[model samples]
Target chain A: MELQQLDRYAKALIKEAGRKIRHSLTYELVIESKADANDLVTNMDKEIEQFFIEHIRKDYVGHAILGEEGFGDDLLSLNGYVWMLDPIDGTMNFIHQQRNFAISLGIFKDGIGVFGYIYDVMNDELYSAQKGHGAYLNDEPIPVLESTTISKAIIGMNASWVVPNRHIENEGLIRLVKDVRGIRSYGSAALELAYVSTGRIDAYMSMRLSPWDVAGGVVIAEEVGAVATNLKGQPLKFLGQDTFIVARKSLHDSLLANYITLK
Target chain B: MELQQLDRYAKALIKEAGRKIRHSLTYELVIESKADANDLVTNMDKEIEQFFIEHIRKDYVGHAILGEEGFGDDLLSLNGYVWMLDPIDGTMNFIHQQRNFAISLGIFKDGIGVFGYIYDVMNDELYSAQKGHGAYLNDEPIPVLESTTISKAIIGMNASWVVPNRHIENEGLIRLVKDVRGIRSYGSAALELAYVSTGRIDAYMSMRLSPWDVAGGVVIAEEVGAVATNLKGQPLKFLGQDTFIVARKSLHDSLLANYITLK
Candidate 1:
């Protein structure tokens, strides 16, 4: 299928999924934890994942799928048309606040991302991108990030990275927080990446994120002249959990060389 | 004047002021720094403060105001009807993102909070409270906060508190960030307080804020049974720059006893 057709279908499917989730907010939730107490997953998350899986399987049967909620196909490698999905990216926020969660989807043709979408469910804002056609927030085209140093740039980062954590050195993250113009934590990686695409924030970095968590955002960020890399200033592996940073080119390099130290 | 009358007037005035600020977003901004480079004051901030001063002086001539933009009265005592206004509570966010800033107003009579309103200008969310009456978010009555322990609560805190700041001990804040269910930094004090009032977040704390920043939020939060205090667990002085923490009764006490070390 063409990239434009795939992007159109992805947008429609995510919006429909968002509508279903919004209607489910009033019902009693069946909640469960994935990794630990703070790692939450709800029945609604599974339902949404299943919804996406059914739509994609029926419409694009040739495509392979990798999804967060175990509702999509198992894959050994990105050898063909693959769809990466995070059915509900911020499940903790979804369960606790009922806002700030998102549906993130990225389409890659033989490991090359062709389309991406991040839908802020409650706010009804859709951020999407097609390769070489540029990124957009809703219908408005997002501009490329302006040049700014770390001292003037606002970063989207969580406090979890600054305290004792397994992935990165805490001291470096602490100093980075103080050095930036400001730090913001919205608790949703997809939305944070979307913010970077729109220049609402200069950069977004997380200590550890899975392929689906960064897939949609990386595609969108790349279109707007931002670079995505792991803590060591290497390109994202798109394979599994790893330290990730999506920032403007110069700021990304400065953060990697000066502040971010991976443990 | 009656508290109801004052509340009505404050709501209308803030709505008008929000409209004006939103309209000014199209024009080129005249930005200047106050204390440091990150501390910004825009022409719109001054214009909005002037707008409030003019309306208050013309309509409620007997009332006094303490405004952030230095356009209102200055007094040592809060004896009569006094308005505490932060024309733009999150000025940095306003100048940069144009989204997260709010107009905060708290009306005091004889040194006690009588009416409060915090208007999220871009989102058009108005959080208001009249003393002895219930709090509201855009005419909908907000409920008193439900009980939650610190381990299960989400905190709205800035990163500045956790990294070598003057007000609170950095080590204490670092531990606190690790102890909470999660930490969020929205960069808007009024919106953070409003979130607590509406149960969107469980608590909000800041190491340093002026009276106008927390005044409107204090009254609204109080209506919902949340307590506001300094890090030392005393009532906020509402004088100049002071440390502030607003949370549920139990969480407030636990934070002071366990994590907060006043510097």
Candidate 2:
């Protein structure tokens, strides 16, 4: 299918899924823990992922899906049309605050990102992008990211990275936090990436993240002159969990060279 | 005047000030730094503070004003009716993101808080409280905060406290981050307090904050069964800069007793 056609169909499906999720909030959620207590999953997450799968399977038969919930297909490689979906990113936020969570989706063809969407459900803000077509927040076209120094940049990052963690040295992140103008953490990786795309924050970094957590944001951010990569300044394979950092081109280079010390 | 009468007038004035601020975003902001490059103040900050002062001076003849900008009176004591105002609580967020900032105001009589208001200008969320009449978000009455254990609680705090800062020891904060379910930083103290009042985040802490930053939030949060105090668990005088923390009653005790260790 054409990219624009796919964009429209996917956006409708995502919005429908968002409506379901929002409606579910009126009742109690059936919550469960995944990896740990902090990593939460809800009935809505599974339901939304399943809803997307059913539609995608009926509409686009050959397209595979890699979703956070186990409702989608498992594949070794991204060789065909693959839809990466985090039905509800920031589940803890969804379960706790009922806001700040988003439905994230990224479409890839032959291992390259083709379309990205992150719908902030509660706020009704849709951030999306198609490959080579620029990025957008709702209907407004998002501007490209401009270069900013660390001292003048507002960084979006969780507090976990600066504590003792296995992925990277804590000392470097501590220094980076001090050097930056300010730091903010919204508890949603996809929304943080959208923020970076729109320059609400100059960059967003995480010590570890699954492909589904960042797939949509990476595509949208890259369209606006931002670079998405591992902490080692290498391109993401989008197959598994990896350290993530997305920022403007110059700031990304500076952060990788001076601030980030990988384990 | 009566508390209810003052509440009606203050809400109208705050909403009007918020309208002026919303309109100001269309034009370019004249930004300047205070204390350091990271500490920003814009022309709108001064203008809005002046606007509030002019209205208060004209309408309420004898109210003492303690405003962020120097346009208001500088009184040592909160002897009579005192207005503590932070026209733009998160100036950096206002200048950088065009969101997350708020107009914070607290009215005190004889050094006791009688009324508080925090207006999230862009989002149009107004959180207000009168001493005995309870707290509200817009027209809805906010429920009192329910207790949650540290293991299941989400915390609101800047990453600065976890790094090497002069105000507190970093190790305790690092452990606290690990102990909590999650940590979030919105770069706005007043808004964080509003979030606490609404149970959006269980608690918010800052190593150091001026009275105007916490004045509005403290009143709102306290009315919703949240406790506001310094890191050492002392009451805030709302007279000067001090360490600040606000949380559900039980959580506040646990954080002070087990997590937060002052330098």
Candidate 3:
């Protein structure tokens, strides 16, 4: 199928999935923890992933699927038409606040992303981008990122990163927080990247994130002239969890060179 | 006038002021720095404060007004009917993202808070409370805050507080951030307090805020059984800038005793 047709199909499927997730809020969610107590997963997360997987399998037989809830294929490589999905990006937010969470998805052809979508279910905002076609927010075209200095930049990051952590040294991150215009934490990697795409925030960083957490956001942000990389200034491999940072080109370079120091 | 009647009047006036502020967004804002570069004041802030002052003077004679833009009254004491207004809380957010800012207002009679209103212009959400009448959000009654332990709490605070700052030592605050489930910074004191009142967040803290910034939020939060006090566990004087913290009773007491340490 053509990329445009695929984009249309993905958007429609995602909206339908959002409706299901919204309806589930009325019922009691079966919650579980993975890795740690703070890392949560709900029944809705699994249900949403299964919903997308079933639809994709029937509609497009050859495509591969990699999803967060263990309902999709376990692929060793991204060498075909593959879908990377995080059914619910911020599970803790969904469980606590019932908001600030999203459904993030990205489609790649042989390891190159072609289409991305991040749907903020509570707000009904759909951020989408098709490679070389430009990014959009609910039918409106998103403008490209403008240049900003580090001192004037508003950064989105988890507060834990500024404290002592294993992934990166806290001293440099603390200094960066003091130097920036301001800092915000929304507890969702995908939503923060969507904010970067819209210029609501200049940059977003995380000590660790999986492929599904950032795949959709990376595409949307890159469409608007933003750069995405691991803390070491290397491109994402999309194979596992890694440190993440996405920002406008100038600010991204400045952060890597002066502010970020990996442990 | 009856407290309920005064509440209705305040609501109507606040909505009208919100309309004017929203309209001004289309025009180029006349911005000025106050105290420092980060402290900003815009034409809309002044215009909105003046708008409220004019209406209050005509409608409620002998009532004093304390507003952020300095267009209101200079009072020696809170002995009579008084209105505390912050025309635009989160001026930096307003100038940058054009959202997440709010118009905050509180009414007091003989030094006791009688009514409070916070109008989130962009989202059209109005959080209001009348003393002994309960709190509300857009006509829906807000429930009282539930108990949450420090380990399960999600806090709203500026990032600066965790770093080296004059108001509080960083060690205890850093430990608090690690112990909490999550942290968020919205950059708007009124909106953050509204979130706490609605139980969207467990607590909100600030290093320094003026009376106008916390007056409206304090009343609304207190209506829902949340405690509002300075960092040292004293009642807010509403006279000048001071450290602020608001939360459910248990969390508030625990935070003051265990987590907070002043410089």
Residue pairs with backbone overlap in model 1: none
Preferred candidate (TM-score higher): 1 or 2: 2
Across A124-197, the per-residue lDDT of candidate 1 in tens digits comes to: 99999888989998998988887789898999998878877888887887789888889999999999999888
For candidate 2, lDDT tens digit of each residue in B1-263? 67678889889989999988877564333233223323333777888889899999998999999998878887888899999999999988987888899999999998899999999999999999999889999999998887889999999999988888898888889899999999999999999999999988999999889889989889999899999999889889888889999999989898998887787
Locate the minimum summed-lDDT window of 10 residues in model 2 chain A: A32-41
Error of 3 at A17 (Å): 1.4
Using TM-score as the measure, the top candidate is 2
lDDT tens per residue, model 3, A2-62 = 8779999999999999988776663433332223323333677888899999999999999
Q: What RMSD does model 3 have? A: 3.9
RMSD (Cα, Å) of candidate 2?
Answer: 3.6
**Poorest stretch of ten by lDDT in candidate 3 chain A:** A32-41
Quote the TM-score that chain A achieves in each candidate.
Answer: 0.92, 0.94, 0.94
What's model 3's lDDT at A200? 83
Docking class of 3: medium
Stronger candidate by DockQ (2 vs 3) = 2
TM-score of model 2 relative to the true fold? 0.95
The per-candidate TM-score of the B chain, in the order shown, comes to 0.93, 0.94, 0.93
Highest-scoring model, DockQ: 2
